[model samples]
Target: MLGAQQPASDQDRRQYQRVKVMLHGRLMLSDRTEHRCQVVDMSPGSAFFATDATAKTGERVIAYIDHIGRLEGTVARVRDDGFALELNTTPRKKAKLAAQLTWLANKHELDLPEDRRHERILPRNPSGILSLEDGRQYRCRIIDLSVSGAAVEINVRPALGTQVTLGNMRGQVVRHFEDGIAIEFAVIQRRETLQQYLS
Candidate 1:
């Protein structure tokens, strides 16, 4: 079951308010064991995650959340169904997390669709080279692109998480579709300059 949408307590609000969310990701334990988990709620300081993997309080955990990237923490508490983590990060990273949480909260409040983070458009040229980390390159067709990522049609499907270069852009293999794979850019691209590579 998902977390309830309840108002935050005064203390929670005063500290860092927790926002209800559903994000899928992998959790790595101190022993290097990995388990699939869903983040039920998150704040800048900590997050509540639901997973089948057993973990003790004070266990080190590293979660690689989609969109949010990696977050390291120690298990603060254990629940019947899941556990909570006390996040450990630098101030700059904490600020970034706060901003991301705010955006997610506002998007949910506005009932906005979550699938598209950036506006995707079909490139004018529709062609680019996909290069693997091992120095292999393949001719691929650009299906669509946005500032955040791109969908390309290629003959080969590299393993998920493989680092690759598409033209001049560096990104990782994020998803695989029947016809192609999706690449999420390491750094968000500038909308004004993105078309230059596409064209």
Candidate 2:
């Protein structure tokens, strides 16, 4: 019995590791129409999003999940509320996804920061353009960077919940300060995504 255990295959891991989550983001159909969706459950191999929009089984989908970045797959099964996604990924990508899920699941259990899994750091290039959905743009200096949000020093203060884009990242104004505003990103962003613009 002691010698029977071995490293599990990806398929085996996928079957056992489905995680329940409430990640908000958007999904695009094969025709390129985007719809707002919420990921209710996920695993490296598959995920399910709760949304009114539905697609036929086998239809290709591209979803941008909050905190998880872009995922491409085909519709596996349709439920009344939503559909399951069968992730198309390489071994490396699957491993990366598994790690992210583990972190999200364990962060709270480990008594880590509840607001964000990662710590905020000063950006390499602090200057950035803050743009509103209404076509207004303002100059801003990045105060700090975290995967979930950023604090920027700007001249204008947008009301809480005002949607804005910092450089290329979409976020919402969550708080106001005398010097600037706090922006929570629409999705949990990869450090690379932050550096692409911040650097």
RMSD of each: 8.6, 7.4
Q: Give model 2's TM-score versus the native structure.
A: 0.57
Model 1 error, position 120 (Å): 3.5
- What TM-score, over all chains together, does every model reach? 0.56, 0.57
Candidate 1 deviant stretches above 4 angstroms: 1-13, 115-117, 122-199
* Model 2: CA > 4 A from native: 1-16, 108-184, 187-199
**lDDT minimum window of 10 residues, candidate 1:** 1-10
RMSD versus native structure for model 2: 7.4
Candidate 1: residue 174 lDDT (0-100): 68
Q: Which pairs clash in model 1?
A: none
CA lDDT for candidate 2: 0.79
